[model samples]
Target: MRRLLLFLLFMVTTGAIAVFSVQNATAVSLRFLAWQSIQLPLGVLLVLVAVLALWIPYIASAGR
Candidate 1:
């Protein structure tokens, strides 16, 4: 069933996030050029960066 498969995928993604966040419970700072970010949870920052990596290209191509 498609719904069952989707449900399982959701569960697996959440489980992965839980494990990753638990394992990477450290604070870190990020900087770029003249910009800087305050310390944030390592896992949280990584997830945001990963999402942006995928999102920026998609947005850039959306006009075509």
Candidate 2:
């Protein structure tokens, strides 16, 4: 039951992201101080950030 709940949660989150990406399909770039990034879709950037957020925690816990 817990696994099924998690699966449903994941599916809902994925669907939300998909709908958001489609609605906000605008190219953008990042600039910080003297550093800058190449243009990319806003949705791609959001997904990358989400992946990094998940990955960092997994790496930290594994190091313990």
Candidate 3:
């Protein structure tokens, strides 16, 4: 049951990403402070940020 739910969640996220990327094909750059990243699809950048948001908390909890 837990595994099935996780699998379903994964599938949904994958589908969402696919649709978002297809809908947002425009290239854009990201700049932070003095650094910048090359042009990338806005959908991909958003997904990467989402993954990082989830990952940071998980890593932070590992030391406790």
Candidate 4:
């Protein structure tokens, strides 16, 4: 229950940030592995990173 509420709060905050970024800028860009990419919003990136962090422990454990 608490976890669900926290997740919902995070989603709402990320959505708000995305909307704000879109309204203020033409687009956001990101660079990775010597490659350049665009299209995804900052809010989406934030959420993705958060999810990746959450999965890191499980992924590391699976290696064993």
Runs in model 1 lying further than 4 Å from the true structure: 1-18
**For model 1, what is the error of residue 44's alpha carbon versus the real structure, in angstroms, after optimal superposition?**
0.4
Please report how far candidate 1 places residue 63 from its true position, in Å.
2.6
TM-score of model number 2? 0.86
| Model 1 lDDT per residue over 1-64, tens place | 9999999998998689779988999999899999999999988887888789879989999968
Ranking of candidates on lDDT, top first:
2, 3, 1, 4
lDDT by residue for model 2 over 1-64, one digit each (tens)? 9999999999999999999999999998888999988998999988998999989989999999
State residue 48's C-alpha deviation in candidate 3, in Å.
Answer: 1.7
Q: Residues 1-64, candidate 3, lDDT per residue (tens digit)?
A: 9999999999999899889888989998889999999998888898888899889999999979
Residue 52 lDDT, candidate 2, scale 0-100 = 95
Cα lDDT computed for each candidate against the true fold: 0.89, 0.93, 0.91, 0.77
What is the C-alpha lDDT profile of model 4 across 1-52, one tens digit per residue?
9999999998998788778656665456778889987677666666577789
Q: Judging by lDDT against the true structure, name the best candidate.
A: 2
Which window of 10 residues has the lowest lDDT sum in candidate 4?
20-29
Model 2: colliding residue pairs: none
The alpha-carbon deviation from the true structure for residue 25 of candidate 2, after best TM-score superposition, in angstroms, is 0.8
